[model samples]
Target: MHPLISAADLRAWLARRPETVLLDCSFDLADPSAGERAYAEAHLPGARYAHLDRDLSAPKTGRNGRHPLRDRPAYAAWMGRMGVAPGVPVIAYDRQGGMFAVRAWWVLRWMGHADVALLDGGLPAWQAEGNAVTADVPAERPAPAYPDLPPAMPRIDAAQLQPRLGEVQMLDARAPERYRGEVEPLDPVAGHIPGALNRFFKDNLQPDGRFKPAEQLKREFEALIDTERPVVHMCGSGVTACHNLLAMEVAGLGRSRLYPGSWSEWCSDPSRPVAKGAAA
Candidate 1:
């Protein structure tokens, strides 16, 4: 019912309704503006663009954590600008299947809109299916009713996290090497928080780039923890970390909080110790 449009399903939907909106959420983490450039070059007919850095994230306050979640009011305005109304089901896609678009999915849920879904396998799959593309942008529609923000976002600050430590299941959604401190490319420091387990976000998806089924995901995640303890996900900048959160939900693990500051912010403060190598 959700993630309503697969690459094939989207084509069917397009045939049936002219009002459907497709969002090109293609993003490159290294070059923040690359997503916008790709959108400008070519996209699905009547599709709009959502940029990860400019449109989806808040201004970096250095200490506020990289890719800080935008304020609710600010985000709601952007949703309107993107022409998403309360009733219209939004289908989001990215280059790596749902890798980047999952953030949009999670954010929309956080905003209390349950009508959003990721485009399974993203643009690659769509083009593979012989879907047509165009540079033409669609006419803007009137903004639909906006939803209220959820009662509380699944998040925890460093202070709230420090105390929990081993008590809760903290999953690091970073690459294995980064989690093990074998290599450090982005951060000044390498490694992860002590007691955290590595579960690279990519693991949640199949080779085809679609998410694994809920039952399979639940079994995998349950093997990691009791499923009774709270789950906290973190990544390099706090962006991809949401992928894990989305996966957890898909797996029927329910609500898991995010460490918004994640590794970047964690290492910024000298007082916070970083663990090298795998956790014992």
Candidate 2:
């Protein structure tokens, strides 16, 4: 089982295990530089910053979403630079409830690395409990070789997605207002993909802003897709959508492919079709 570590559990692991790799993935879509500045000011001891814009995503393709997935080989090479070798246990965290950190988690899973987990409640929770913090930069790693990634990553274009509509399960992790086109906070178009199910990523959180347990998460996801059909996960910019992907994994619903462009890229062109309101 993939270990889900609470703050206390992490503290325990820190004391006994030297193999723990803590990654700081704090990010801000509005102010991109804020995350790095914050990490430099004060971060968990031995934590390394993983920039969402640079380290995790690819260059913007005007038509593609704001943050598209980098090529698997490129990403694998980047991971090697970050000192992540095969079979290492990784712990990712962010200021919010594992929001951005989950992206790191999802990408690692896509690469078939299973010994990874998100820090519950993220930095705020860690600080609330008086965990240690430092401004020291982590040591760089010697370049190591990485295995070749799979060529075919399961993903769908908007045109291709239209035909698969109800046949395969599609999930939208955006807010209800955005899903309904009531008000769009980030995109040019303010609606969701037709036939996409709405399950705001925040819904996966508990009252404490931490993710709910696997049992509850399983119930929520099973309502949409059985384990049989492959699930396609999407969101406004394909960032927070990772929250759903991570939750589903914790829920034991298995892995799902991400629509990296999500609503942002989906609505970039006037020619692409747009759907409003809940899925019919």
Candidate 3:
């Protein structure tokens, strides 16, 4: 199945399959609580809220990125509490052009779940289509044991990434300014990894806030690297990097790995080389 589902398709699915799990993955990096407040005011009917800082990320140390991946067992337990059992179809959405939603999708895939997808265009598209929004929180289900399954997604650590930069197609999903070291409002670092190419995650979307056509995405990425070449994605804190990974999947550009520590961790270690300006 595709990694993305249209709002219309979701509406149809809701009518036939009420048991389908819908997650509101909206989040703002600037204001941590904004997502929950917005979710409380209005969200897709039957959508359960998932906060980036709370549900998706782990407690951070000075060395770790601002938002680190949660521990596997703990994340699995959280999924169990969210009533997400293996084999059930899950859909995740966010208001911010899927920047946050894809993180949810990536985690589910990592946890060995195969039937998860992101809501194409997220909450904005759903609302634009006149879909109903409700504030009623869904009831929790009895926690089930989330089996210890091997990770299905591919990821690289900072140590592994440094040596392989020259061989792999390193893609940075941050804005051009951040990539060029002109401005960095979030992470301590102002530039990107040397030899990495910039492809802002938002560029994957159309003006309507939906992802571009698969053919278009394929064309855009092919210009950067061959369709079959091994690519590793990175962004501010490993979050938006998943957007590029998802876009590659949608474009059928072949499987790519993620550098989970991303620029935050890289910049934390001053010894790692940082490149400013456009791709050389």
lDDT of candidates 1 onward, in order: 0.80, 0.81, 0.89
Candidate 1 lDDT, 145-256, residue by residue in tens:
3556563347788999988777878899888999999998888888899889988888888888878888898898888877887888888878788888877777777788
lDDT score of residue 159 within candidate 1: 93
Worst 10 residues of 3 by lDDT: 138-147
> 89-175, model 3: which lDDT tens digit per residue?
889999998999999999988998888999999998998888989889878873585777888799999888888878888999999
Q: Tell me model 2's lDDT, rounded to 2 decimals.
A: 0.81
- Best candidate, lDDT-wise? 3
RMSD list, candidates in order: 2.1, 2.2, 1.0
Q: Decide which is better by lDDT, 2 or 3.
A: 3
Error of 2 at 249 (Å): 1.5
Residue-level lDDT tens digits of model 2 in 174-210: 8888898999877778888777889899999997877
